[model samples]
Target chain A: MAILNIEPNIAQPDDFYEALIDMHRDLDAEQSRMANAHLILLLANHVGDEAVLREAMQRARALVPTSSDVSTRPA
Target chain B: MANVDREYQGLAFDYVRSPDQDARVAVRHPVVVVGAGPVGLTAAIDLARRGVPVVVLDDDHKLSVGSRAICFAKRTLEIWDRLDCGDQMVEKGVSWNVGRVFFQDERVYSFDLLPDSGHRRPAFINLQQYYCEGYLHERTAVLPAVDLRWRNRVTGVTPDAEGVTLAIDTPDGPYALRADHVIACDGSRSAVRSLMGLESKGRVFRDRFLIADVRMKADFPAERWFWFDPPFHPNQSVLLHRQPDNVWRIDFQLGWDADPDLERQPERVRPRIRALLGEDAEFEFEWISVYTFACLRMERFRHGRVIFAGDSAHGVSPFGARGANSGVQDADNLAWKLALVLAGKAPDRLLDTYGTEREYAADENILNSTRATDFITPKSDESRVFRDAVLRLAKDHPFARRLVNSGRLSTPATLHGSALNTPDAEAFGGAMVPGSPMTDAPGTMRGHPAWLLSCTGDVFTAILFAGDRGFDEATIAAIRALGTDGIPVKVLIVTAAGATVPSVDGIDYFADDDGAVAARLDARPGTCYLLRPDQHVCARWRTFDADRVRAAVARATCND
Candidate 1:
């Protein structure tokens, strides 16, 4: 069995999304990035399992294109 | 149609001069309530019914101008039933139970507010706020102890340790009055609140909405329809509701940059209505106004001896219709305690519970309305994206349906974790726990049909459930011997056996042949629930114990 389960788990998904949006309401770009970093660190600490954290990071990174690939590709 | 139009102008209650205005000093009254709107009139009538004299003051001589607060919830109807005006409201209002939601042009999900049968009132009724005020005003006129004075504006309120003194301005002249307690039910722009230098603090949404009451003959079903980002109006919301006398209330959401004055003109408003109701809709405008709402409330509802109720105490966005409904409930929670305190039966500390409990309720209303408002009007682009995603997903998945927020309709706030509750000693199974309003069930009282809620009088009531075996002689005698301590406790015995018990003095019997009451209350053979004057459960037991009941009553009244 997997240690991390992330398949539509929240009882009130909209409330979580709302709170997340509200958290970033008044922040600038730098502040928003810092807030995201802090939030990730806090959530990672709560996850505790190193393997699960590594898997989450890999899954999150796979969704975005690499900077070098985007630079070399045509617009 | 003429009568409805005339009510908009208001039947003038001519300004009458009271002898108190000519007194040497400020004439002292027992209780003085400010404002003649639904909340104030409710408080006055409730107090007068309890045999406490109340003087109600209002700045205006007629009903309010527009049809504000069109939705009256079932809980409000129940409170009106206790106050003797529910029949009139139910008769004149348009009752509805079904509500539909639409994302873009396609229907998302529909809901039945009252899925269960056997309820006395429908889930909600759409009536003009003026009609509610008229019914409450008619009820107040018959109550001898309620002195409702029109055009009596309270300009100044001074509160000392003993009581509150007011400076009133009437058409005849100004007058000074004093009262043991003052209940302020003034509207959101409360002069009394400003006089005290207090303010309500909350987040104010930047968008404005146009409320138009259009008179037309149409065949739309009497159901609440809400649309989000429809083709008629893109990137906004629209709400359609049915009122009495062929009047339909349509609310069109305008962005923050829309001009309020420009939007009220017929040229602008007519096109919007025609856009939603087609070119040949044939409708005449009954009323129109542009309003911006905020979710805020006073820090405390009570300041010394002056208590604020209604919009003066708290306010919410119009999405949930929680404003006037919760205000009337504030009066319901307050009147009995004030009556008891005035009669010297309970200590003054009991009145403090009203402030705390209602403040807790106000916080809940603010939170819910704020959430609904946030969903309806997203502050950020990301938030709007999330909201649209929820609406889109709601059309397919059941889990996402719970995320849709089209104003959770108003329901009675359960006063859980109140200071007045007696902690339970035994395990209970249902929702009728301490500090919860008792659920209503259809039953028969002495061979006549009645509601279980109507059987509870406006006093401390002990609802005894006779499951299989009837009550013992000792318990019945103890119930008969109650109230020697000056605070009366009325007894209502509920039996599911469908047979009458032996008649005893000071005890009423209810036949629950369908056993619905038993199932709703989770009652057992010897269970007893102690209800406050407001019909909230303060204590309960699996077995009948008169001593425990007395202790709970004492705690409920803040005597122990």
Candidate 2:
């Protein structure tokens, strides 16, 4: 099993959005694709509502494709 | 006798009967700041920027003499940048990052400030205080709202519920003037403070220090060099700092019994300095003065409508170079408060924080200067023995080596008992609380470390975690109410997995980021943050509660 380690409990939507924008600005297209997926998932986990997390996951998946070769994990 | 116009700069003057003849002319301003020193000039500039009419008075006929405070810290430079003078000051100042200490002709320790990992500004810069004053004066002259009145003095000051009135004495004549507020930037012997019946309370050290500014021609390292002991001066030490104009500021720790008259004589002091140099080097003395160190702080920074700033409020030994720096900060702190109160943006209670906060900083500076003084001049025999032992140990121990090598020794100001600060149970546990000094991190507040973040589209929101599981829905609703009439809050709740959510304290429940969602929030749970206009923390809570968080925001931004 490919273990996807996600750090839970994202605080403050404003700060989360700022981090997202910063990552998008700082990272390249390929890295951003991978990072955005992780960010969305992390944000969903903090949401803690399983239904909301599922809906956010669908929105995130449409934005960035998750690949088997690539592991969606935080460094 | 020559006559000069005391009203405007560059205006030539005709002869007058006497200096008192010029004192008859009266000038009026909404706010009058006494003293044209660095603190007074800076306050005038800031107040002018806020469109407050100001008149600055100084009794001195010319700029100050000597190289009095040559060191400028980083935060001060940032403030200078706001005044549009940072680039000029930085260009003219010399940057030094390394320092060395010598004990008994042997180098005891050395340290490098460049490797400190993250510093927004340089460790230290050396520029003569005269240049700083001249730069500020030149800038203040261009500000139309600011009037610089040289050779003007306030002989008396009286305050009532209405405003502050000053009995002003100009070279032309004496006049009575009234101002909304009066700021005293006069030096340590502040006549304003004396008239206010406030006393500076602290210890006065007996030992006298001799500071000499001289032009030296030597191939010495361009760094702060200190000799702990000299052969001829067994108990005394020598301190040398390089200045911008190729001049050197040299200080000698003279014993308490040293004769001031003989020390002032070049014949006696010059030989002693020459002997330390080993070879007979030719140098010209620019200025020399003997001063005793006193760690004193005013009991209260304000009395009625009159406010005390800079040396008038506090005095510290020169060892840590905190005197001038802290004084400038006092001016910075007070100027903004006075401007706000005058402009009617904040309540009168905001002015109360200036005394509470600045007095705390003044006391901290006194403590640091006192420590430096005690280390340099051991008061008791036991302290002397211990200092000597530490110097000996510093020669070999790596920890001691690190301590001795970094020549700059001063503590950063802390926010405790500040009217702006709120109580935090886990403030020391790495949570970004309100009133803490701001740091430069991507998610942190820009100027202050508080949690005020604004999104790209101008939508503002705060983030809180379940650090103590204390927040509830009502509190969140209260904070959301602060949103603009149209802009609704998008709340995001962060909670630990498998842990029971605690009872609501006051925060509103938002969406949680758990499992894959956690990757999106990017913030740990149990952490709460509030952001303000510039995307900085207005307030933060470890546990959640809507009402408390909203109240904190209101308090910080003056909404309440």
Clashing pairs in 1: none
Clashes of 2: 76
The residue ranges of model 2 lying beyond 4 angstroms of the native Cα positions read A1-75, B1-28, B117-120, B401-408, B423-433, B440-538, B541-550, B557-559
DockQ of model 1 vs. true complex: 0.05
For each prediction, how big is the interface RMSD? Answer: 10.1, 25.5
The estimated TM-scores of all candidates read 0.89, 0.69
Error of 1 at B427 (Å): 0.8
Lowest-scoring 10 consecutive residues by lDDT in candidate 1 chain B?
A: B1-10
Give me the candidate number with maximum lDDT. Answer: 1
Question: What lDDT tens digits, residue by residue, belong to model 1 across residues B323-434?
Answer: 9999999999999999999999898888899999999999999999999999999998767766777787678766567778999889888889998999989999988989
Looking only at chain A, give the TM-score of model 2 against the true structure. 0.43
lDDT of 2 by residue, A1-75 (tens): 112334455678789879768877867775565554444434544565766666655665767746743566653
* Native A-B interface contacts kept, per candidate: 0.00, 0.00
